[model samples]
Target: MAVLIGLAAALAGPGGTAHAAVPDSPAVTYTNPVAEQRADPHIFKHTDGYYYFTATVPEYDRIVLRRATTIQGLSTAPETTIWTKHAAGVMGAHIWAPEIHFIDGKWYVYFAAGSTSDVWAIRMYVLEGTGANPLTATWTEKGQIRTTWESFSLDATTFVVNGVRYLAWAQRNPSEDNNTSVFIAKLANPWTISGTPAELSRPTLSWETVGYKVNEGPALIQHGGKVFLTYSASATDANYCLGMLTASATADLTNPASWTKSQSPVFRSSAATSQYGPGHNSFTTSEDGRSDILVYHDRGYKDITGDPLNDPNRRTRVQKVYWKADGTPDFGIPVADGVTPKRFSSYNFADRFVRHWEYRARIEANVSPLADSQFRVVTGLAGGGTVSLESANLPGYYLRHKNFEVWLEKNDGTTAFASDASFHQRAGLADAAGVSYESVNYPGRYLRHYDYLLYVQTPGTATDRADATFHAQ
Candidate 1:
């Protein structure tokens, strides 16, 4: 599910000219914290061409809904207070993690709430919304969702596979003294659990067991014939992170044995990036509806004065999700702040990505610690209207031509580096769906790999063009 730009033959430049053009399918650049003070985010894109967003507000008193034609629009979209906690009773206090879902022509919101008498008496609840627009619709309380020994239950999510609907949530078993664990069961109705619940995962790893042996916030995504259920673990502080469970699309989801838990977290805090406790994520699609995006919340800083729950800086962020060759997701690191860039993979070698080895350009297998392979595709050198590839890990260094060879060199703000670094992005001469990078100065000569090393050479035949084409992922 990586965002990719296909190769094109037309030469267009950065300034919207024909000298060298940006990728025909340009990358959608966006900043982090799409909305402030929004935690446990859930973004659902409906068929009506609008993305609906809901999450736990800092006050933890009510559920809110916002919709936008584009993802970025949610940042400024006016939020409607769809439902509030009851003055007394089961849902009278501490409303949290509200997710809006449209099922069977009716909209249902699954959320967690506590009692005004006892805030620790947390349980799952549902709100039914009727009408075309959720903002203007009427929401009615559907009462508490009864589960198998729900000592502390919350974060309810649902998904369907092979026409069978299933519900997954975080709950504490009566026999267990530790934190919550993930459970799954077949759903007879939106609010009714039909069968016995089976345990899918618990906090076992050191990362998950940190601060507290907790597992909560189960979100589901079905891709590549597989179901991936990601849940948050540990305390809601810096130790809070994301873990995942995988099962085949055809497998019996109701059986706990069908799902396998990841030994390590799939996504977590990135101290270098200033993103802490990145968990409680929901999955949605890009504007083009061609890429899967991960929507989650994380604190900007690590330090907090009082209880982490009281620190209301957790903001919503979105990034594209990439899949490994084996069809599993590679969440990589919680990326740094700013417009996230993409990686380049060779068309001839699907597993190999364009990277730097000793500051020299080469193609290698896409593996863990993916920062080395990522590059910021920016406007070309000297304002020549082309494009330049800047290293993600090494900010000042860029891919430049030296002696007709590509190398990662530091940007010295010199004319030579600027000219050598520029490249004309064009469509694949061999593979029409792929992309080819031709040297801006050399014109006909293109960037190609030979014996794993990248060099500038004129493509003569289909084989030469194929070797030169790359997928901008």
Candidate 2:
């Protein structure tokens, strides 16, 4: 969501204090690649007020954990190798996808490992920690988790619904044609699954069969009285994406009939944003517990030499999650590289977003080259208490007004350009939670979309006010 400041009555000149309901503070911003070379990332925020993070290290030699007070801080948080791989035998090689969770007043880590003699002999394992802090806690190996006919398995995650705990994961069933499929079962405890495991999804769609017929990395989140389960599809290349299954909160989660799969992938690689093979995501909330964040791994560039798994450039990234009116999430596109850009959706036209096409500014839905719709709200070029909207794709170009029409133009480093490009951000004319931008040079004129085109005008009607408002997220 937009980092918005409440509108106050007071107005100020350049270099003066900006008016807002709260005191002025710098916007919380972060760049992509929250953690480098960390794939299959998972983040768990605990009650003690720290976000615990873990992922697959490229070397596959050990399980590491880190904690930070904020999501962005996870980038630099010193990671501790809680458990190293065995010298031989079980849990010796191919260690992957470690997820840390707080359960029943203790910490549990669910991960997959293979033996040195047979690197692909993957199976799920559990590690228990009894102390308040997992980093310092003495961990005990719980050995391999027994699943129903686990030919090959990994990416185990556990969640609670009502009072019953459940374990969800991806495992290869010898009877199935697909390489792997997602399964869910009621958990007898953190390390054991009870009853028969129900297969929630299999790789049957064309998108799921790219390079490999796979459905792995299952992550779950519940909202709007529904439980959403997302899993990775395809091979670990640019074709990797996310597919989801939905079930009612009250449904019998273990019964395969209770779940419905989405026909299309929920999130995927974005050529425009330069994020390749985006999948294996875990959800967490913002520091203030106000917004949901998607944490996953992707390579910055598309082309990789040899096998994608051996490339070792998959970096963990995070982006804000926006919800539709129907209470479902719109992952949108993987954002452009710098400053975690946001797309401004028109308040009245929820489907339409403020975007630039051929340097012309307008509001359009399903914008081609989606990056054109994203903008970074940076400090104003005029250096006053104002802001400037910089195009995400075109780094140096900004949205500026000329003859009342908005256009994306390059910063020519002139006073006229700065004045035209800068705007005084105010509370949304239609909704205080949203935002409205008033032109710096043209007082009383605000940025509004009319006839699908962007303009600086004095909105006089309710519809006009709504059109003037935009949600930047």
Candidate 3:
């Protein structure tokens, strides 16, 4: 596992030509495990300027929620228990995987629960909130959804496409071998399934059938003309991973033939990152609303004594999601713990991203093996709105300027080192949507790559500005 160290470092000395003092404006950043023992995480940013969060508590007894103005604020936000399980009837035991959503000016919570007599007989249920704020709203219990069979069902999520609302979930078909499969159906309303359910995907892949044949926790996100449904598979242990299903945005969502499943898992456990059994993920935009962030839960340690559920270390974590050239989402490896970072892809050359080769900054093809290119955008050494880039693969080393050249080096604490490491992060001087790194010491000079080598240069034309522009992941 990669050790997470502090971002604070000593300022460089005189004539060192690299490090500078830490910035005055605190860096806008957040760490992983926003909350502890919170699994099956879900976060949504509403128009009211708050990011609401809910997840499966380790006890699995009730639904709790929290909201904050910023993503980082959720860590300390007070939790509110909006609803509790029934004492003996249907919604009585094993309350799990609660997701809160606002629909038609009201709030609805879709969750899985089981009867007290039959604790394992889990099924989906809903709670309608009547007030404006979900935390203070009155929740009315909606009964279990009747599916094709009274079998095991859970993980209900809703989304709208074009003008139609649909519900997607996981269920055990009577004819199948006790394996959970993913299903989708058009919604009559927020809590009811209007039509027959269509089985979108089954646990047929080898990875999906690992400890147990499973496919659950369906999350939907639409882009362009494609509907992306991501789900968790296998047992809820180290074997747990994420799989994806895709369908056309205009396709009949109730038709089983319309959806296509991936042969392998899209996201999974990473021993190097100290995150095991990483699954049941949700998606939301960044605080800036310009990037898509993946929210999920995972065990911090690999080894567990008894059942993985009892371990209770499945902490909620978040990371930025990137995109491929073909427009498909690229959820890289589960990152190592600490502050997750981003990659800067050149605007002029979209395929090339800024990376380090032998401690020297360079532009390389942005491909599958992405760790080398990822860097943490930390507070710059020089104060006044400047920022520094710290390498993801090589911790403690940062991108610093020396002799008008960008170099990845270990901060040795010197005035020159501090001055060279600081750069003002700004909107792309060329492309408004893109970004540019202007040197704090050199003033108008910006970080740009020529012949794949990074250097500080003054831009005088559109092409020069384009060379200095980059799309940060």
Question: Once model 2 is optimally superposed onto the true structure by TM-score, how far is the C-alpha of residue 136 displaced, in angstroms?
Answer: 0.5
> Residue-wise lDDT of candidate 2 within 312-428, one digit each (tens)?
888899887666557677676676666787778776665678999989999887675556787888889987799999987777899999999999999999999999999999998
As for lDDT, the candidate ahead, 1 or 3, is: 1
- The C-alpha stretches of model 3 lying farther than 4 A from their native spots are 1-29, 347-351, 356-360, 364-366, 379-388, 393-447, 455-471
Which of the numbered candidates is closest to the native, going by highest lDDT? 2
Residues 440-468, model 1: lDDT tens digits: 88889999887777888888765566678
- Count of steric clashes across candidates, in order: 10, 0, 15
Higher TM-score: candidate 1 or 3?
1
Q: Quote each prediction's TM-score.
A: 0.86, 0.84, 0.82
Candidate 3 overall Cα lDDT vs. reference? 0.82
lDDT of each: 0.83, 0.86, 0.82
Stretch of 10 with least lDDT, candidate 1: 12-21
